[model samples]
Target: MKNALGSVDSVLLLGGRSEIGLAVVERLVRDGARRVVLAARGDAAAIGVRLKDLGAEVLVLDFDAERPETHERVVAAAAEFAGDLDVVVAAFGVLGDQAAYEADPVSAARSMAVNLGGHVSAGLFAARRLREQGHGTLVVLSSVAGVRVRRVNFVYGAAKAGLDGFAQGLGDALHGSGARVMVVRPGFVIGRMTAGMRPAPMATTPEAVADAVAGGLRAGAETVWVPGRLRAVFTVMRALPRAVWRRVPR
Candidate 1:
């Protein structure tokens, strides 16, 4: 539950090892979140220890984004351990090889299953609990790439498009139930997931994204754009002519 000051008492991070996810959890922990549940595929011992150092009672639960059947169980387990979840961050995704996806379409589909499908399942499971408890927030990490698909990473962008829409619709459905959703759209993030890649023009960091999300949640914003200026940048980018848009490099 959130205190009168809006500081949460517990948090559930679905993607325990995600750079941005960890940053958000850390921010929440510092903002007075005491009980933390990290659900990831493998042992997130390092993350658990890091959260513990921050004065959070950290618990790691096994989570596989590709396995939708197990998502409900994972959510239930987290609730059992932490009582009513105050915040659930659905921050699991993959940046697959675009060229490889073109060569192997099946691989693209499989990856999208986890990238998009996993969130669908997990988001719903978390939403249900929040609805039953009648209060909570679900933070969905979307991307600017989804605002409009690019020729370069269309495969990944298309899945994000679906996810972005799903999250918005979920937010509307849960509007009056005392539960809410926050969608974060960040430009090329220069983080562990994007290591060695050339930074984009408006590239931000995990910490920047985390800060934007925290502020957004406090303001009751439905959507957040990291670095803030990217919102205006994307507004122009989304309005460009298709011919010119196609030539804009990522």
Candidate 2:
């Protein structure tokens, strides 16, 4: 049902423990979301307590990005939490070391399963629920690296590329169903996920990405870039020739 936020009352964050996802949840709560369903791999009691303290009715659910078979159930459980699931945030991802990925193809494949295949399954389930309900929004966390793969992190980039493309296609498929999809592309998040990694030229924080996503919801934007400048930067990077782009170090 509708709330003071102007549209939503319930939100489902796939990556409940994700910094960006939690930030987005905070924004939504401030915007009048009355309920929140946090789905993550481990126990979500901590986050649930924090959200409950913030005045949100919280529901904790078990979710594993590496397990596609569980995605449908997760979506169903989210819908059950709030008769009308107004928003779904697909923010689960893993950034493994490039060297380690190179050394172990099996481990690298698992990364792809979680990053790419997981989104595919999760997106489809979320879309079906939203479409059938005839209202809702799906926020997919994409990456700028997906705009164009880089040699240093091509594997991760490739996975995001696949996810980005999938989200775009799903958005189109949901066109006229009263359900919308917003894709968020951030450059580099220097939070817990990338704690030790060097910040990119256009690095951003989880809060910034969450703010952008909140703004996008109000504006009904199909896509958003955290910090905004990354949009312009990627415009140039996407057009660069491979010969010249390959020399640029990460």
lDDT of 1 by residue, 1-250 (tens): 4444256899999999899999999998988889999999887777789889989998899999999999999999999999999989999999988999999999999989988999999999999999999888999999998999998999999999999999999999999998999999999999888998999988899998988988887888899998789889988988999999999976
Model 1, 21: alpha-carbon shift in Å? 0.1
In model 2, how large is the Cα lDDT of residue 196?
A: 83
What tens-digit string does per-residue lDDT give for candidate 2 at 77-130? 888877788889999999998899999999999999999999999999999998
What C-alpha lDDT values do all the predictions have? 0.92, 0.90
Looking at candidate 1, the ten consecutive residues that score lowest on lDDT are 1-10
Give the local distance difference test score of model 1. 0.92
Model 1 misplaced stretches (Cα beyond 4 Å):
none
